[model samples]
Target chain A: MQAKKLKYKEYLEKYKNCPTSDFIEVERDAFRWTGTDVSLEDFIPVNIKRKPPARILDDSDKMCMAYGLSMFDTLNNALKKYFKLYKKQRIHQQEHFKQDKGTKIAMINLTKNDGIADLPNKNNFGHFTFHEYKETNLVGKISDLYSVFKSNGDFNI
Target chain B: METLIFNSERKLKTENFARIGDLSYFEGPLLSLFEDLTNGNFYFFDWVDRDQDYNRWIIYRVLPKHLLNFLNRKISHLDLFRQRPEKSVYFTDIDFENKGYFYYSAYEIESFPKNYFPNEDSYFDPEDCNSIDRIKSIIFNSFARQKSENEYSKVYHIHNLKTKTNYCNQPIGRRSKRTTSVNKLFKAIKFEDLKNSPSFDYYSKEIKLYPDLRNPVQANIKEDENKYS
Candidate 1:
């Protein structure tokens, strides 16, 4: 029994580096959603593995940490840029402090279903496809978008 | 809120107060067969394709901190509630036939030698079976009253340490006709929500029942002996 389980454990390692390729293909008039037909392609398999929550931190906690780290980096870079632009400004001045801290904004996703991919489907024509339909509300706050660099502006559609 | 897997028909056993159910999930036949082949590592539950003598609904019970870490470790995906388990329980239509014995693993396997699924049964100890009377007390807070068909018993929640905040009402995964964004399965419910929801109450302990649930025909003898019996 031990030997067999060991074999399975070895086998599972193959799935560890599961491929994360972009959609496989998009076919013309192959996928249907809400009365619209579209072609779709490329389906990346998300190999979900079970892990105890007590042993690992939750996703939300990790997301919050990422947000905080990015914000810190952003503040650091903004201060560096301000110092470079105004080299003659004294370190103690109120204007320098104001310049170091730039105005920033943040947007929170009110919809809880975040990071979902299009549904995978098989067409009658023997082709694989992915389908997507989205509706969400984004609530914005006059806070920070934490980053040491400029905002990417790569907004999710 | 935490996620739970239960046989819906088991919930109806409130009348008998004899046996409780084991936690079960569907797996591929090969994997299931492998587990069964192991030294009684897993107790066999019903095959998903059982005949529909009765509908054995495999419903997800979303509660805060009710599930064990061992069971939680088996949940590989967040979208489990959206997918139907393979081989749903089918029942025979005849009313008088005896079905079979229920068996399941009550213990969780934490660390194991590599190369196999990370689980071990608490053994085939029938004595470890749960008591319906205790479950009824936990659910309805009453000892012996039978639960009416439509009268939903107060669902019970265990305090899962993983969920400090409940998001059970929030939309999870995708939306469907029978499921609303707010009412979707796997959604977390806040502690306040768990406290306030009309459907559930909290329980603090576990109870065990001996022997297995089987037929013991006791006639009501209300009308006739030979005719009714």
Candidate 2:
């Protein structure tokens, strides 16, 4: 009559075997954000330039290095969750939280055509991930896929 | 045991110099040359996979500074050792293994010429009496290859040398791995090609030069209050 608590291994197995389709839906929105320290040129996918922090995911054996996004139904809900997680992580790391400057958030539309995949991770429930197999393929595709905007103002591109 | 004796004999035969625990010693211009080579540019490529587990390679474009850092612990990264890809080198990092043991392949782009010397003002030359033998002596004397994974292959281990105690906890063995990806990268890029390659410009171009005077999140809250009031 009581619910079972999942162990770490069981949790890993549950997510690993979880049906991919359950996590991602076509035409659903995914949100990703960059810190205020990042600039616009960081979004450029040139081989010589450093990638934007939002676009560069943590390296892991379980998953290929790719852009990490949180799937949410609305922009407001996504922003609230993003800030909450950001604050929690900063506090966990014993780092001081700095004032949000001109931070940028990108909203990406997931479609069957984009070749994106759902990788339900324990770190975040709504994690949607994608990666380009080749470096050259990423050069022009990044800017085209996501609609970016300033978090504070009406400025967007 | 036998390997250590052989190495000591080789050093003595070549350089006529032998020290008990000290690995190698250089003097004058040769010291500067050694410093330049050890601290120079290098490309590091590493990845982890379900099947392969962990793999890494250090490809020396000039010489390997990473190895020197590993030896001396000049820079410490707490638990993780991460090197991001730039114009010059590939990206790599190790998160799981905090055991203070590293296994990665290391390769020199191309072998230096037998006749090569640092400069015309050098004391010894191949054309002179103390020629190719002296230069070869320096190379062999400096890093003694103790254990060989293969009969023909050379494996240089610096475990016996006195190393500084640091956060990463002094990794013991720096062994080499033989993999197809390492060979491919070695063949694809050449030492001459990297001469004109773009240097790292991440700090200059990507980082914000100035912090914002006002917090955007706070300003957003104020805007919402104004609209409601």
Candidate 3:
């Protein structure tokens, strides 16, 4: 019923510092005010070689590393993929939202196709979703997003 | 366990990930990364057969505490840690940047793209492999091969937030959007601090930090399961 306490002196000398230690760390990718926060390793811990899971705080609830979305390249890559498929489709994106339960779910205008296919607004026009992440069943996907505006109340869009 | 001595004598900690923990609880309250009692992996799932009692979730094993604090300092004042392989890792006394700016979603001091570190390829084609199984295998292998070292860690991208879309090869900040992307944010962090600081504030991590991995239920390990098994 009791776990073992970690002895610090054991691996202190082996800490890969410099470039290795200098690498930025943070919460998982899925953590969100609107959605879930994902870890470097999906779940199989042994798979986190170079990623080395982020550090936990004193309380263990707070994230040590930081989070930033790679929008430019992401959008660029998405557009490139869309173009490679359609060849001549104009692309566009508009963010929309609604309050449900308590979180905000921003719905992107997917005017043409799922963007995975191709058409107008096809550059990187895939749908955007927000949701919470699960830990046991290996379930991760779109759900909802958080909004500055109150949910189920006065909204601008 | 002379793990360090053994590693120096002969490296055993392969780049593959190690098991941090498991998921037996799921009642639902959006768990924060460092919360005392939250799920390890932060994703959502539903049973193909709802009545079949099958649900899949993710679990994250929290790494050493000092690692987390170090990462926080790096990202919060990202400009400081924005060095290539040529720089040294040390804390500085330079005033940290705290300009309040919300780029992509959260409020970040600086936006990305200004300091984007381009990888060989930004997007990964699932079709690169002959079949879906091959793609999954590629993902599994890479995940297994990745190093826990911080340097290589930069190229890897995984999220705990709500966005389910797979980022693939695209590093953060490849876009010119507000900032918040990975590449740009890390690029913008104030590396100058480490280069020029009077007080070694960030350097003394071990002395100043309380290495507690029991972070309630929040987020974020290295490898070494095979040999032990």
Ranking by lDDT: 2, 1, 3
Clashing pairs in 2: none
Indicate the worst ten consecutive residues by lDDT in candidate 1 chain B: B26-35
Q: Per-residue lDDT tens digits of candidate 1, residues B1-229?
A: 1122333343211112222233321110100100111010112222111121221112122211222222344432122222323222121111112222122112222232122211122211112222323432333322211233212111111232123233233233322322323222223444465456553332222211223322331121111111111
* Candidate 3 lDDT, B69-181, residue by residue in tens: 32333322122123222121111010112111111111111222222221212222222212334323322333332333322222222221112233323343333332324
lDDT of 2 at A88: 26
TM-score attained by model 2:
0.24
Score chain A of each prediction against the true chain A by TM-score and list the results: 0.16, 0.39, 0.16
DockQ for each model:
0.01, 0.01, 0.02
Give the per-residue lDDT digits (tens) of candidate 2, residues B1-229. Answer: 0001111111101011111111111000111111111111222221111111221211112222333442243533111123322212211222233121122212222322212112222221111111233333433432432122221111001111112123123222211234323223323433334234441121122112112212542344344222211
Query: Would you estimate the TM-scores of all the predictions?
Result: 0.16, 0.24, 0.15
**Residue-level lDDT tens digits of model 3 in A113-149:** 1111111222233311211121222223333333423
> Could you tell me how far off, in angstroms, the CA of residue B46 lies in candidate 1 after the best superposition?
16
- Determine which window of 10 residues in candidate 1 chain A has minimal summed lDDT: A33-42
